[model samples]
Target chain A: MPSSSSSSAPTPAAPSKMYADDVSVVVVLLDANPFFWSSAASPLPFSSFLSHVLPFLNSVLLMNQMNQLVVIATGRNYCDYIYDSSAPTNRKTGNGKMTALSCDLVAKLEEFVVKDEKLGKGESNGAVMSSLLSGSLSMALCFIQRIFRSGTFHPHPRILCLHGSPDGPEQYVAIMNAIFSAQRSMVPIDSCYIGALNSAFLQQASYITGGVYLKPQLMDGLLQYLTTVFATDLHSRAFLQLPKSVGVDFRASCFCHKKTIDMGYICSVCISIFCKHHKKCLTCGSVFGQAQSDAASETNKRKTIRT
Target chain B: MPEVRIVARNFMDMVASLPAMKLDQLYQNAFICQAIVRSLPPLAKKYVIQMLYVEEVVPGKLIEEWVLPDGSTKYRVAIDRLVQLRIFSETFDRTSGTSYRLNPTFRVNLQKHITIGGVLPREPMSATITVRLPSLEDLEVYAHEQWECFLLQLINSAQSERMTNISPAMMRIFQRGLLTQREKDAPRLTESGFQFLLMDTNAQLWYIIREYILNSEELDIDSADLIAFLLELSFHATGEAYNMNTLDEIQRITIKDLADLGLVKLQQGRKDSWFIPTKLATNLSVSLTDSSARKEGFIVVETNFRMYAYSTSKLHCEILRLFSRIEYQLPNLIVGAITKESLYSAFENGITAEQIVSFLQQNAHPRVAERIPSVPENVTDQIRLWEADLNRVEMTPAHFYDEFPSRDVFEAACDFARECGGLLWEDSKKMRLAVKTEVHMQMREHLRGQR
Candidate 1:
């Protein structure tokens, strides 16, 4: 009711509003991090995750008759298409197609975890990390491009990344590249973080792509948050006044060790981030102080590379 | 004017004609309500969803605020359509105070559909039918074949001989004595049939299905039950066979009828049977205005009026014949030309230039479809001009008067005719004047009153 009364005035010539029924293609990126989920700090338990995600996917699919869904899992070994509605209508004729897809997704995730465990069994505190956001996003973009380039009624695609685990610092460049391409294609990359802290990479992805990034206070209302905030298509999103993000986390992860940093030093030539002073750049192998020892020269170099 | 004919009523229009109480009753059926919501104009559907959970009648001013400043006209139009459908109830309150709300049953039903995914009247098909269900592709083929036969029968295309028989119930519905003569041996195509061919697939489907619903009374199938069943069929999985046992007597009969019509395909199993929804049935609940999705093949129309239709469907070829004269046909290509003779015949058969152009544009080859104006400008305009030529000399109700005694009298009559605003033609050489038939008496009285 804030600007309710004042917004009621009519314009001289009302534009002919058209609510288009363009097909919506949604690619869901699930972070299959076993280590994160097994930890008690995680709000979304693996079991809780399956229940919410499946229903949310179904609801999204049911929202429009022309809607298409593709679910990609970032497993330890590799990223794979877990479920795709565009694939030949489910071959398993006995089970309901949706339930069949759901079971297949569950089985695949379980199999991925078991495989990861076996691979990590030998070493002490061996970590099984598998949140390949970049790979999944690239694949999603390719899939969108393929469908849209040929068809008469190409669907408007949006990617939803459910990030529970930490960011993959190694994929910093790849992730940013994907976000920019997605932004260029008008494909919003919505991210829902269910874990402890905010993901710097995901926050920027959502912001740049004009999609919603939500961190719910109550993990129990994850489905509610998804259906209400993120379920809307690109057209409806225009009219909706979304939850205002207080501030964007503009901090960049260091290129050298893939670690998040504040007040980081950078190599001017390569534009690579470093936690502290280094002679040789790890990214592009650029020698920094060896070439220019003066502090004023270093300041000039940094000034040229201002982001 | 030649002979009074009943204006056609499409399925949606028939539903729109139902009283509020009947609409309320129909809305109680969740599938019917959902289908109505889905098929409504996009703006109207948006309005319905916005008001779905609102507690009370929202003020008209609030509606205006919801859309952009330039969207007020769309808001009003959307509301008007909603009111017509009895989905949105409008209450007058002088100027900006007017308020509206969803019809109670429609709100509850659509809400249940969107939120909880309302329980189906019939349970999901048990394991028995699923094992032997037809593949999606086969179901699609069967459905398409059946629908093609049905259309072929209506137009009495050469392929109608291939069809076994069209159901009497359908025949009764299709033939309303409008332009159709109920002759059995050779069902000649009427002007309406030509116009029907020019309509897009979605519109044709709606027209045919609505005709069925309208004739439901004579067929002894309740209109409400038929609508509810058809709408429910749309929500079901396409190409998946469901247990026929789950359907009641009325639904089972309707399913058989629908299967015959190619909306659904029925597969016989060991113990029982199952009905698999085809694309036609599955698309029933989709937006009626989804014209863009119906782009099947490219029908290329060149500037020289040569038409090349790259389609394998006989139905497409037969429809093309309604406007363009076919020169020859190959396995996957049809060569035709839009000639003056063809255009005149098409125009005479009640096919408007707009419909012909739209049909051409819709079926335009991908290369042509992508062009700014899908059809060549010269061809579209020429077609329109041909149709316009038929209407050039408009008949009017006017009386011609001549031979005034003097120039002043002639001037007076001319003045009277002009003042009446009914003068069709005037000539000073012969001092003749024409006045409308309705105004003739008034003019005569005015002249006498002046005298």
Candidate 2:
């Protein structure tokens, strides 16, 4: 019999290596900044954007029976988890209804957006606000860590950030910190930029964490871009030819002026970047002599020239 | 450290082996298509989704370019699997070296499934109609008990306390390959039955389900309809009660049979009756390679060959007794030891050393499961040695020929047997030779013709 023959083969004298199961837990960080979507320059409207995103989320869950999903809405000032497929409360409503996940996701997102809009009612005077991308990334990482600790089997966890808002230079340090943490945890951060300009923050995030960073040329095919490029799990990414990143913007924003610069004076004590020479570092309050500032600027100029 | 590997014939393999027409028919349902997509290899799934919206036939070289040079093997496997399942239809033309187009039905249905998901065929009955539905935990216990009772019935029909509920038809499915019955004696475990007992729960569950589906044809049921319904049933949320009025005649009967197997728990309320899917039913669509579906380990084996199983179930005790000697039993623990005599008897019953080692590893307590070798190395080695001892001697049937008039005839006969690839042994001095029973007739005819 097949069973007897298979069992007769000499068994390996070691624990079977654990294969990376096809299952994955995708934590989607969706940019929900109303200011970005409400602007006339935005390519995709909020409603149609959701129309594309809902199906993509459903596709991720449908890819594998054990695959999990978590959707966190990144608002201008705060971020909150909108939906989790593995949560017991979500499963209870999932019952025989196939669209339960989509329904729940949309309703919760609408509620969150309304509340966020109410808080920002006075600030909607044509001023663009950046979505809390850094906070959302940190939240996604924490959620992944919790899943890893709570279960014996670890599903391949990843973060997919779908944001169209422009980057806020003030949040550079926090975003970089989140990026490094994600890198350390081996979680890839996939970024899908739906805005006219490519997001420099997300480009670096994806590059550092070994994930796909795509800015689709046409926003009309957002769903196609999502399913084709961002739907792949980490395990399968090695085999598929994902869109290659052209280049990453590694320039750091200066703490003094919040301006991104290719070459800058960095405070040795706190590693804070500055566009111009400063006797006193604003960040760590460390003092520097004239000679030190002159020498640092000379080296910075040489480094920029060589590059 | 000896890994236990059960040759689980997963549902996908069965689906892949289906005839082309049947496969197309199976893919007609959106849920089945989704399940098929779920069961694909990771690369294959990516290919399907990437091609879900593309209407044109993609060149083979273009698909090949998607993988790195090192991933050629994976790429080949993915393409082969997709073609075998008919999810990707391969075409060849002189102009375009080779190309593949997604199966129209599969593409359309899967696109619909992803873009616009559909609800299950049946909806859950309202709380008022199906009052006091069992909790998820209770449903799990019910499913476990029912499955265990069914397996116990297989081991020994009289050993199961609740054998009365198992119909003769259901029992017949279990008897086909696992048991044999004599004219005047009760049914006995066959060689395969011993191996079946050593399989983990998920493998065993799949085995029975496969048998049930395979046997459905004899009962005048369309196997295709049964498969679709079963896969759809897996999509139902566990512990939720679905109204029975939604099912057709065949489904109604199938649901009853499934209840006996503990896939679903049948409940009756004041004026309505509904069935609640248990974890088992909900896990049906999950591929067998997914080890996460396995229950947590409960058996802890020490290096000294002593075992402590923290399970109170009688089924656990009975299964343990198959290859180990039971010392004593506590309310929540079963103490056992792996001994030579017990292992020898187990080997005699056709259970292999690997199965025993794997059974132990699979059931190792969560505390020790993290260890490299869940079961002690010495115990696994000794069990393997004992099994090797039984395999030391092998018996083969042969026909011995002697008393040949001349060495020439004997030499010719030897050459003839050798050429036929059935020569067992030969004695040059005595002009005697032994040929395999299968080739004896040919050898005898050749010798007679030479004379």
What are the lDDT figures for the candidates, one per model?
A: 0.71, 0.81
Model 1, span B147-265: residue lDDT tens = 77877766656766566355765665675542356556455557666666655555667777777777776778778767777888887777666789888998887788788778888
Which residue pairs does candidate 2 place in steric collision? none
Q: Which candidate tops DockQ?
A: 2
CAPRI rating of model 2: acceptable
User: Which candidate number has the best lDDT?
Assistant: 2
Q: Compared with the real two-chain complex, what DockQ does model 2 have?
A: 0.37
Q: Model 2, range A1-307, lDDT digits (tens) per residue?
A: 0010011211111212343457678999999988889887589789899888988898888888788899999998789999998788773433343467777888898899888878776774646467889899999999988976976666668899999999988887788888877776778888998887778899888887778889988778888899988887776775667798897776677778877777777666666777887779887789865555676756743233101
- Report interface Cα RMSD per prediction: 5.6, 3.3
Worst 10 residues of 1 chain B by lDDT: B1-10
